[model samples]
Target chain A: MPTNKPSLKGKLPTELKVMERLALVEQFLAKLKVDFEAAGFRRNRLVNDGIADGLNLVSNAVELLAEESYEDADRICRVAWIRAHFARAIFDAEMTEHFLGEGVFLELDDGGTTDWRTFASEELAELQEEIVNLRKQIKDRSAKRGKK
Target chain B: MIDDVAKLLSKWLSGQRSNKLMSTVVEAMTEARQKVRASDSPFKSLARKCIDRAEDAYQEAIYQLKDGEPKLCFQHCKQGLKYISMAMLHLSDLNGNATTFAIEQGGADESIIDLSKAIAAFKTSVEYTNCEVTVEMKERLKESVRLFFLAVSFVEREDDNEAKRCAHGGLLYVYLLSKESEEKLQSNAVDAEALERCHGSAISRIVSLIDELSDTNSTLQEASVESHGRIKLYLDAARRTVDRCISAYLDNESDALSQLAKAGMMELRMARRLIEYAKYPTSTAEPEEEPIEEVDQPTDNFRGRVARLQRLLRDEDEEVAVVRRLGVVNTYYSRARALFASGELSEAERYARSAHLDIDFARQLLLDKHATYSDLI
Candidate 1:
């Protein structure tokens, strides 16, 4: 049976907690990558194709976290999170086009086509809820650790 | 014998139209008076008696000029001018102006007080006298005196080029004055001859002084140029080394980063030395020895280089918080290095990432502003 515990010996509880938080960040990044790809966004062409608008901020955060500068890492993460929302909006627009057709979402607003806006709104709401929950979890964990 | 000597003195004073020859005779008479007193001669008072007769001749010349007797006035005025010139020559040794003149001859350090006094004497000689001196002559003498003082002041301030310029101006004014004096007294042969005899030697002395100052100015300018060239080379080398350091750091080449930082420090030191040399081109101070803290330790060397860069950046006047941003990068980089050295790989990686991000931001801002790294330095 696999365990959630780190394999490294003599790990402090705080270090283990930090490791857990980093794992969550990695999961979010991985999900973002997959979603970006599913939306026809190339990983290498994110900067050139203008798909992953917040990739630079994400990359900077990843580098800062690796360098053990938590403050700078946190700062870049906030910027990346905000940019990720913009990326999601772009993804949603692309998805609406791929699913229905170009201008179909606009037609839905004028009562001339399918109600895809409702679906997009619901999807965006779910994504926002997940991001808010994750951000709150990180903040709560940090506050608790600071108190200790 | 005393009466015979007095008669000859009067003849030299009245018959000779040349002030230079008259001055020479007066100087000889003065010297003979001193010699006679030293020899215990019973006729020691004879030389003193001759000077008194010369003074009496000057008084007679003034009276003749007032009486509208141009011929007698010319004779008396020539004698009068000769006496005044002799008096000034004797007083020049005691005055501060003499000290300034001595500076040109490499005799002593110049005193501004003495120089000003000398200039004042020249000015006063033209203005204070009741004698019928020409306005053009007085104006030229005043200008020459002013230029000479200006030149001396420039020399005191170590601006040799300006000193040379002022000296040249003084010489030119003296020449123009001489020409003007000659033109005014062209019809009067006696007066013209007397003016030339008195002022010609003075003009020649000024020319010689200016020539000497020009030589000194050229030597100083050469030294300044050489020092300035060295400063430029050092600054260029410093800039290149700093660029290499930044590249090495970005590439994660630790060894190259450390080595480049050391090289940058050396170039900065050279630049500082060259700047000082440019300021004091004649300074003979030895080059300072490098600190032992810089050598035999890569970390310390890197820190030293960073400190120097910080100092250089802080001294710059920037519209943005460039120094603060660079400081943040440096802080992160140092933390990363320390963590990495201690085997905390994950923690070190995070700090290094922050450093890189900050560096990128700084570089981007600099680029956006169309400024170079040297501008920060």
Candidate 2:
């Protein structure tokens, strides 16, 4: 009875817990690296430069984790995660249109060029799909982490 | 539409038909095409080979007709007819049965197509704001779009004058909207702009809601000078509801807090719509038996802690990371929007406040990241 263990009284199921949203952010970084390489997109300026810059937040997150600043590390990574998700979705749509021979080069606020179609509401369903999958992934990963 | 294209084709064809060599070939192709009138033909398989070639050539010729020389257009058209004739000869070898249908081509003037597409693009450009317009300006915009549609219809009939008038009407509304935007933008100065000017804070800073809500209140107070009529009533209701909600939050009355939150949200919505409606400029002053919402100096009634979140959201331009300890706050706003769309407003509001901690905990977290988060889920 004096064991230094959490009792199973009035506890919510571990599977329903939502704390490990960071798990999804980690996976987002991993996936982006593989996707860019597979798509033959070099992580540099002139192509996906914003995403490349944003991905640096993950390294910062890891460094904070080493320093035992879990909350700040999570915040940093989560910011990077959503920002990266947006950049990835935009780039994915742009690349799709390019491959389909329907993309146009639009000028950015900064005098850069992109293959993003100016009118793009059709691909929103794809965005919702990603969000759903991400939620599922978060739940599963959170459950796994709770075991430790 | 057909008459416009046919005039061009008939004028060209009659000239071509004059040549003796062309006359003989045209006669043969005409007979071949006429021979394929059967509804059910056993020799359809035999005729298919030549018909495929004929259709391909005809399609290619149509594009040539769009831009290339009339000579190339004619050559491709003739190539298609030759294939049809060969199909006829092949059908004759199979006891003269065929299932080939007639191959006809038509073209609209390129300028007409271009103009129609341009009108569609104009329709899209109008939905987006030139700054933010008043409702009267939007009513004018609605009329403008109506005229644009009329322009599209007129262009279809090739009535250039009617189309020009409609297009001009649409552009005039747009011009008025621009003028309104210029006047509106020039006249009012917002406190939030000053807040935004405090750099190293663009979408990155931990926001304090007190500053933003005060800014919003001040801006509304400025606008409340004009005939806000019933909007003032709604704002008053919203502000009171917010105060009650904050009290409920402190008293641990979750049920009352939920009801008060929803009531406050509704009041805010009505206030917004009424403001837009009241602001619509007309020739005469609106007779308000009820006086407009009077903006008072920071009274005891306006100050509430948790209530500020409701007001802060109305600042659509508010940075997401305003409060400390953003436990999925940004995504919650977005998720709440989606849930709102799916007719789940109750759940949406819950999600929107998904990061709310105990008041004391929040205060501590504001100082540092050491807050109890039992309510996050």
| lDDT of model 2, residue B153 | 43
How far off is residue B198 in model 2, in Å? Answer: 23
Best by TM-score: 2
Which digits, one per residue and each the tens of the lDDT, describe model 1 over residues A4-114?
211233333242233233233323333455666665632322212222434454445434443455555543433343233323333444454445433222110101011
TM-score of chain A of 2: 0.47
Q: For all candidates, what are the clash counts?
A: 11, 1
Evaluated against the true chain A, what TM-score does chain A of model 1 have? 0.40
**Residue A140 in candidate 2, Cα distance off native in Å:** 72
- Give the TM-score, chain B only, in order for the candidates: 0.22, 0.22
Report model 2's TM-score to 2 decimal places: 0.21
Off by over 4 Å in 1: A1-148, B1-226, B285-377
Tens-digit lDDT track of model 1 for B250-321: 233567756765665665565566556666757747455343221112333344344433323332233245
Q: What tens-digit string does per-residue lDDT give for candidate 2 at B1-377? A: 89989978975774454333334445655565566655244444434644665566556656765663455555556655545644554454333311111111111111222222222222223322123444444444444433443444444454545454444434433433333343333421112332232223211111222222223344454444554545566666555554454345323466776676666565565555555545554633543333333433222211222233322221222233323322243345355545645655466555544522322333344335355655433
Instruction: After the best TM-score superposition of candidate 1, give how far the Cα of residue B263 lies from its true spot, in angstroms.
Output: 1.4
Q: After best superposition, candidate 2 residue B142: deviation in angstroms?
A: 26
RMSD to the native, candidate 1? 43.7
How many backbone clashes can be found in candidate 2?
1
